[model samples]
Target: MPPSSAQARADTADELVTALDSLESLTSTDPERALASATEVEHRANLIGREDLTMRAQLVRGYALDRLGEVSSGGRIAHEVNRWATEHGHQALLARSHLQLSWFFNMIGDTPAQLEHALRGLECLDEHAPARIRADHLQTLAGALITNGSHEEARTRFQMAEDLAMQGGDVHLQIKVLNNRAFGEYVAGNAQAAMDTADRMLALAATHDFPLEITALDTVASAQMALGRHAEAERTLLSAAERSVGSRGANGEPEAQILLTLAETQRLLGATDRARTTLVRCMDACEEGGLAGVRVGALREQAELLAMEGNYRDAYELHKVFHAESEALVSAERDARARTLQAVFETDEARRESLRFREMSMRDPLTGLYNRRFVDERLDAMLGEWTASGSPFSIALVDLDHFKQVNDAFSHAMGDEVLKKVAEILTSAVTEPAFAARLGGEEFLLVMPDTSRQEAVFCCEAVGLLLRSHDWSTLIGEISITASFGVTSATASRGSRSALLAEADRNLYAAKRAGRDRAISDPTSER
Candidate 1:
């Protein structure tokens, strides 16, 4: 007798989930295959009506598309998933979506947007989150932080990510994190640190019986050269090539990188003929690996070789080709960033999920800023600290300036757009130790822990200026918008939550009465 229908359906569900896992596994090593598998898994999940699985499948598909050079479509998919995940309270999907968006931003060289998304992704991971997923997002955030010039923070994030990866026994993730950390250190001029990190990556791969990480080797060679170890660098490259077992690398491009680095090492070591020969091999590896970026480097290397050989004419010609390729690569990615988001998905599940998510939200649904409930909870603890230890802190009550004329003239939707923009400015202004929250409507509060009254006042003023000078027409057609702030610092008597806010509120009212678009901090006049 055939299997029962119920059993068959259960098996099918499990199979689809398993397929999704396989697709995700192939994402980095073989994106083309991952894309195909993702499509198939998506169909299977949809057929079975597993909304979560479908969302996961779509996210993986977007990642594969991005790796395969379809940035616009992938970004659209990612954004749609993000919106849906946010509505559903699906933290896993939300985290992945932000990670994908960060990737899109990084590809286009939008460091600020990349950093923003990376931070959001890291925020979404909780204790129950899978270790591998947590490590992936954390590692990505570390890279973004480093690129944004926060090396110390980046190092801490990297260490955390690597520790997580090691705990999970994910050898590949460990290698990847170590390699990236090393390269980031090298770029930041920490040569010894880079070498140590690269060495650790190699050690991890060797102990795990995994293929040699060509990228780590390349990083090691670069760090060696940076430390003036010319001969050592050459030896490292040779060992990497031999371990790689020909031109093909763990990934195609890394071998080309190794070859180019070797050629550069030779050139620096005064071996002109050897460098020229190595350059030819580099060009061959580049073509084989479809490494256009590395090919450009090879061309520049060839040009330098010719220049060294007293052939300035040929050298200059090759340099022109290299320059053109370089310019085109940069221009192409920026142009791709201009492709607007064009994805939409609507279902009763999504609609219902939004209402559910909103009910549980600690953050405002519209601006994604923390809501009053979250602020109240945090302030309760903060007040206890202030009452116990007299720990200094400050709060700024912010209110947007308007007479409801703009809302009536331009419609409430446009007014909402203006609010969101203000929220963005406020959100960006707050650093790690400080936070901004939406109390309700156009009212917000900035809480600064361990900050002086003067510092809080300065912060509010800067935010006010940003809002005042912002060209609102870009968001709403030709309009001026500003904000007023009331700042107050924490003290023993003011530790009472109501009293603290009332102080800020009085100052806020004073600012509104005097003139909008200004910050008021009355450290002198107090109860």
Candidate 2:
């Protein structure tokens, strides 16, 4: 007798569960294959119409996408899973989802959101949670806490994570924790502690012969650099760069970061020409790999190199430019308070929670600004609004030039502070009818309702001035900020959201190419 349809469906579910496990396992080492597998699994799960299978598949798929460097899309899917799991009482998935969101925020340099999600992830875990998951959660939470400047709590969490990893015999996880812990100690300005941790991690890696990547080496090099052991750091970084290139290929962020450190060491060693050449190569790698964080360092190194050559005039000008670029990292604490006020001002429990969730879903948790999802959905509606009222609607895509360096040179805490400050500036810049949103990364959006194209351009110009003139020194010493604006209007292209954004993006890049810290509007438009 043939198996019943119910039996077949049950068997398929069992098979999908197995597939999900395998898919998750392979994601880091084989993201492309994992992504392909995830796509198939998602399709099959959807066809089955089983929430259990569908959610699990999407979680793995999101993880795969994150591993593959599709952070934004991966985060969106993970966020969906988070919402679903929260509403459906799927505790485990909810925790994992939070972890995914934390990682996503980390990638985008959204430290506040990363910390928030990391905390939430840990809170969601229960006694029954798997040892590996618990260990990872602890490690993530510790890293977030360290980034946020909570050293005592971070140390406790780190110890717990370390113990869990050791007890579980997870050599790799233990190494990851050590790498992060060492970096965190360095960021905390504890060179000795960082060096000690790095040594322990190296010793462990050597004993096990784990194919650990160069993050630990980079931390050790950084510690050596901090201690003024330039020659030692140079040698270490050179070895790391060579090994990383051989194992992970050239032109990746890790390798680029290592090259950046190498260049800095070379500069310190008085190899000005070699430093310049390495800086050039590092900049190229950064550009190719979109390593904005490392690119900041490369730019600053340019200023240093110019100074080394006794080109004071060019060096001073370049230093000014470098600091201007660094201004993008500013005050996240204020963003949090604003979000809290928003939540508190909402009506009754149910309505308040609903509004909170709605806002959270639409807003980028890091900046407390409307996210891309909100932009995508709201732009069409705003287009309709302008179409109906016969008024004007304008938007400008603002990108922070050399913003990633804030996180790279200084600690992420400083970077978080900088990002928040920028959001605050943008918030203050916009009026009631005009609001700002963070589109992702270091990009922001300004939407002006009932405003003409000319008006929007003028507003953007003022914002540029505000950003440039603002006292960024209070946040990151001797730094200033500037952004490139690509402004567009409904009158120009009301057909679709993508069309409007594409034009603005084009003009934005034009401004970037033309020289940054300026706003540009479409000159061809019939105003």
Assess every candidate by TM-score.
0.61, 0.59
Write model 2 residue lDDT over 296-387, tens digit each, in one string: 77888888888988998998998887776666422343454344333323335436644655566677655778878889998888887777
Model 1, 175-261: lDDT tens per residue?
A: 888988998899889999998888888788778888755666788899999988989999989888776655462345666777788
Question: Poorest 10 consecutive residues of model 1 by lDDT?
Answer: 337-346
TM-score of 1: 0.61
Residue 509, model 1: lDDT of 97
Worst 10 residues of 2 by lDDT: 337-346
**What does the lDDT read for residue 110 in candidate 1?**
60
* Superposition error at 373 for model 2 (Å): 30
